[model samples]
Target: MKLKGSMWSCIGLATLLMAGCDKSPPISTAEEQPSAPKKQVAFQPDWVPKALGSGNFEVCLSNEAEENGVKDLILPVGMMFDSWGHMTGSLRDSKAFDGEGTSGFGKSDQYALALTARVHLTSDRPCAITQAQAVTHQGFRYRHETVPASLHYNFSAGGLYLNKKGGITNDMKGPAGDAAQIGLLSGTPISDVGDVYRATEDL
Candidate 1:
């Protein structure tokens, strides 16, 4: 699919979630990137090249479970802090980040929760994320596997929703949406998914 805006393919989530200020160069999409043969795909998370989840690499594997199967990508982010280093509670409460969401109504959210996403790959079944897309509160589609020069790639919530009638507050948190075309692979497919991805590069 043809996409606009900054795009990061293969392996770049760790850099996207990094806590620094240096700007990264703009990332372009793999519109012309050749897809790997299904037989030739390699499914490797960050540990092989470096220590697991070290530096700026995120291993994209989640625990297969009896519950919480609504999403394949889930993580608990630390509460946001403002410029003065004051705690920003949750996205909705932080008026500094007021925006609209799926609801299309402008209301401050009462609660927000960044669920814990442990930093290890529990299941290595390289998934073919058949259909995935993410956007911002103001409705900007993004494909960021790594952090952009803007410093954050907080996507408007796709799969997950807020607990409140006025929840989630329309702030950005990344989540590669549905694995619509899912199938198990012994190795990684040239991952064509996320808000994410690089052109089949090392993590």
Candidate 2:
């Protein structure tokens, strides 16, 4: 995907070049950089990763059902949020698939849920992501894994949303709590997902 305002990449590369240059005149130890103080960026709620229900669906059911039969899929449609309050990730993932067997054949049975649109994320904080594509091992049941999700800001709203890509917002209307939902299936329990965001903030 093409990113807007990618000149930052050039600037970063230039910085690396200057740092690595050997032809530049050697400087006295005192004249050299003492090392820059680590920057501590202030957090903002807007930049926190989030999911806003777009009231759309993005799933397609084919003619296939399990022994117990199956129901048409119901997927969440929403936008991903960055610390800049912009959408950051794609909504499609493995969790979107849920159904039993062989029900999509009939005209009445086939259904489709598609990503309608996404909001743009605007932020200066470096986004942290853990792509499923990054998984080193595959097809192992009960294998323990903890992937980075989102950047935290408030350290209160549980810092920021993990999985900067933003998760599915299954419940548009709330009997569930929170302004946004995190994690897959949109149907994941609010408390659990929220807590994960919170705990990761400490790191």
Candidate 3:
């Protein structure tokens, strides 16, 4: 009987030792694990058009932000209107403007679209442009086309009269004008024109 009891005690000790050896530490949860930092994304502006007139047609800018930090300025040329005041077609143009120059105010970084449109207006009614809407890419500023103070507009001639800044005007009229022009006396480089649409903000 003594020998049998001693054997049972030895078996119990061995089992306990095996169980202790097989034990492992608890596993970690997903919340306890460290996560990598998120990357920063570049900012981009939405293509939403502000109200310009009683009609739905309005001048708008491109929401696309170029890598060189240039935004295209969109101008409304004209929109086809039915007899009932409904819009049938929209005509518009765009010019790339560099907001960042040696000075905060920069020139047109690219050629401007020759803005022209054919609208069927009644003889009694004359369509008039009252306001213009300027759009810029998100995270970018707008640079207006600069003209010499001497430049002036002549409504009767229907043409821009430029002096002293002749080269600038010539550049604006050239096939490869590098800046946007703002004035009544100069003709924009005539090329392909694009339509302007409302911009949506990118989150």
Q: Local distance difference test, per candidate?
A: 0.23, 0.23, 0.23
lDDT score for residue 2 of model 1: 9
TM-score top scorer: 2
**Tens-digit lDDT track of model 2 for 73-119:** 22222222211111222222212222221111122221111122322
* lDDT of model 3 at position 12: 82
Report RMSD (Å) for each prediction in the order shown: 19.5, 19.3, 29.5
**Whole-model lDDT, candidate 2?**
0.23
Clashes of 1: 13
Quote model 3's TM-score.
0.17
**By TM-score, how accurate is candidate 1?**
0.18
Q: Model 3, 185: alpha-carbon shift in Å?
A: 16
Model 2 ranges off by over 4 Å:
1-24, 31-33, 49-145, 148-203
| Collision count for each candidate, in order | 13, 26, 12
Candidate 1 lDDT by residue in tens digits, 1-203: 10101122322555655625557776788686876533312222331222233222122322222123423433333211111111112211111121222112222221111222232222342222222311112221212332221221112222232223322332433433232112100111122222421111111
